[model samples]
Target: MITKTFKSESTIQTLQLVQQELGADAIVVSMREVPAGPIWNPWKKSAVEVVAVSPNDEPQVRKPQPPMQMPPSLEVAEEIPEIEWDIPAKKKTAKLPPPIKLNLNPLSGQPAPVTETVRMTEPTAPSNDRYSPPALKKIQQQLTQQGVESSLIERLMELSAETLSPSTLADVEASKRSIVQLMGAELRVQKGAGAFVSNNVVAVVGASGSGKTSVIAKLALFFRQGLHKSVTWVCADTVRTGAIAEAKAYTSALGLDLKLVYTPQDLKEVFNGEQANDLFLVDTPGYNPCNEKQMIELGALISEMPSRCTYLVAPATTKEADLHQLSASLGVFNIDGLIITKLDETYTFGGIYNFARKSNTPLAYFTSGRETSRNLETADPMRLVSALFGKEWNK
Candidate 1:
């Protein structure tokens, strides 16, 4: 038998070549397509290789010959004995035996035996070791040491190291800046006319214990002290205990006018009667988000008020889930912007990013420490980004 292998881009061409070389009866034993070179090369596409085998000419067998008798009277009968006839006789061809046939059926009590041997090897578990630098592992270990859960640490490490790898510490800072830029792009608000109003009539509304009183006082102080604008405090929080007196005292301390409002109707009546000159800082009652009545009343009050509704989101030491729920619950108020407080607490301030992303709420101001209005600053995206990534900001 003869065997041949041919490789070509076209299977039909390869078969034709094989048939041309070895007769048309050539049988195809095996065929496959395999990559030959790099994928970048246009001519390196996978091609088919065919392996073929053909039968060769069979060998002939000799036939057996009978023993030859001696030439009878060859030397006496002939005039002169032929020299060729005196020579020994050659043997005749003998017939070959029939070829043996193989039986392939197992039911016929004739089958080929197969043997298999398997060597037992130790089982190996999949490796969980990640291909990362020692610095990343150290950072993960540090976070774990600081009581951070393993799952969150793993996520943080993945976001920091794998997604944002830095060649040097400086590059790490640059990467952080880029992430902050992306975050800022998400949080950026449309640039409007100056201050929404020359004398801004801002109303701070939120749930109870959301630092509404403190935020009101801070805004009043910020306008009076920082911007030197005349500020008026409207004490609309008549529900909470001592809320009225607290607002009065804070307004008195800053030497600002304080008015009492029992309902949204009364707030509108008073505002319409009085002339609008200075900033009217309306302080609303701290309504529970879960209470439907309070939300309805607050919504009515906001709809009536002449000032812009700025929802105070005082997220301090709060979980991300709670913040998300709060943001969703208060979304009915149609809050214009956010005012985040209690920034000094909690290193993992992922809630800020969550709120900015999920709520699509732009930040207006942020208060860190409880210093009345000392640590309060206009919430700029670049500054917040720098703080979250621990990047130094240029003063």
Candidate 2:
């Protein structure tokens, strides 16, 4: 799909520009009021920002129609009998070089010293087993070793067998690697740390203990050092003990701006005042996805904002069911990407990989430890595949 943003003096003007640029079928994704300058700059006026989307530019594929049948016509060919006639035969002759005179005896004639010829041989390819063991069983074992679910493993192995021949699977290493690559071929990843500095607003949300505050801090550090930009830290988790304090400490140490918002109105005001900041990392209170009241509270705060990239953080150590439920419970918050936390806490990331596909969530970033501002890395396809396959190849 196609997406674009338009900013203007008012919502109507911004939308008019969006519809004009994107087309009549374009969809409105987000609309919000933003500051004309740094949020704290009193002279700056308020402006509106609008985001839109349209169908992808790709051409749709049309199915082919069956060919029409035609009437059959019969034809006959004539043949003639074969006859034999006298054939002439050719005499065989020896192929030899002209005779040369011998140096030792002037009268004697000798053929040139029998020519010595050397034959060249071609280089040989490395030999492989002519045939492999059963393809499905072998692949299933490898996928299990990588921690992929049993059901997915079975389906993948069957697809592998259909695409590959026994001889292709004979080279176990090459065959397995190809299958793993296929598994990661469609992994969708968003520009993680880099996007922080440029995006106007970003809210980090997830279940309690999912590391929302830590992720915000990590992103702040990345924005400051990695991207060489200033950051504004906002804490909307006033009800959570130690949440504001933890975020305050990180922002103070970095000499960045810190703001506290107890309500959506407070956040809107902060966004208007903090215009000078390159990025805004908002810390949200973690909730129990099973608690409907808590989920509504969390979703309410974000829904007030017109345009924000919402990141749902989840622990890497969590179970498949919990991950899916966490995403589903908070889906109302308009989640844009996923940030997987506590990678150092778990070795098997197959569930994370599998969950992304099952939920259709775009992976954002990964945190490896409890360190407030370190161990943050982008969610990369190669890295996920390398971690799963237990090797560093092609990462």
Candidate 3:
């Protein structure tokens, strides 16, 4: 038969090509899928390859020709002598023992339940300590060293276990991408830039030196310029040095108003003078979470505006232990979301990620540098996962 090969993006197309060239009588010999592009590129699309043969050239089977009788002289040349039979007797076969029988009747003369037998035969669930592939173990170690909590790392590894394979793991880039996708699934991000809105006073609170003011200034600029909303700055931090002057500098530049409130009663007056279509950005003094008096006063101030969006701003450099402590102490504010700042000042981001995940807080924004104009960004799941995996956030 005349043999030929045909290739196409699908099996149907390949079969059509084979039929067109070899006619309707063509026979398919074999078919398989192969990479359409270079083999090294795993993302390349696959093509179907088919081997076919034309029926017109199929080989014919010949009927066995009658065996020509051997010539009489050739057949008679080999004369042989007769031999005597000497056979032995057959050995006896061995038999197996009979099967044993058990009594199903109980001493009480009651019928046995069928469920007991099924329960005894049912299989058990697999152990939690499953065999982790070397690739997954390596990734777990990487996450651990990057300051991720053991619980969170274990969870991420468990979720990623199914996606790993010997071949896929060999490609380092592919493994990392898988990790990004896995961790991205766990990350929580705020939906939009609605943190600052009219009728809700936006407040920021955290431990001292957590870059609360920087975040506030960046947010003011964002709402004023980016969202094109009128921003009125409120500096509740009357005790901090240059707090008023700092608020003045930003407000004067943006041509917005600023208010200084030392007490919740004073804050109430500002609330009474609220204007239409105006965003209120309140900057509270750095709180000492352990200081019961300070926490109480912070809570009191937050209580003034029953409808407020309070963000707990924390530096990315904070340790996991301290993050938990802050969450416990400052949880009384009824925090609406989180704003992570000073991202450029630290290398490890696992602590924050674990904190947010465990506490179920939605990350609202990320601030890297001191530049109030360009450093603020809306929180993103991919960016957080990239940071966790040692990849550049921008990349």
- Candidate number with greatest lDDT: 3
Segments in model 2 whose C-alpha atoms lie over 4 Å from true places: 1-139, 145-147, 165-168, 191-198, 391-395
lDDT of 2 at 149: 73
Tell how far residue 132 is off in model 3, in angstroms. 4.9
lDDT of 1 by residue, 1-395 (tens): 77778876655445545555544445565556656677788777766776666654521222222222347766423121111222335755433222212121112233222121223457999998777656656554544443433565566556666566456323544544544565566675524312443335678877677787788888788877766677778888888899888887887788998889887788877666455556788888887778888888888888876446565555655666767777777776667777877777656555565566567776777777666848777777767655554432223
Per-candidate local distance difference test: 0.62, 0.69, 0.74
Q: Estimate each model's TM-score.
A: 0.57, 0.61, 0.64
- Model 1 lDDT, residue 335, Cα: 70
Off by over 4 Å in 1: 1-130, 133-166, 169-184, 189-199, 226-228, 274-276, 386-395
Give the per-residue lDDT of model 2 (tens digit) for 248-311: 7877887878999898788878876555546777888878889989877777788767678888
Clashes (backbone N, CA, C under 3 Å), per candidate, total 5, 6, 0
Q: List model 3 lDDT by residue over 219-296, tens digit each.
A: 888887777777888899888889788888877876878999999999989988666768888999888878989888
Error of 3 at 62 (Å): 99
True lDDT of residue 13, candidate 1? 49
For residue 83, what is the lDDT in candidate 2?
Answer: 24
Clashing pairs in 3: none
Q: Poorest 10 consecutive residues of model 3 by lDDT?
A: 111-120
Q: What is the C-alpha RMSD of each candidate to the true structure, in Å?
A: 21.0, 35.8, 26.0
Highest TM-score scorer: 3
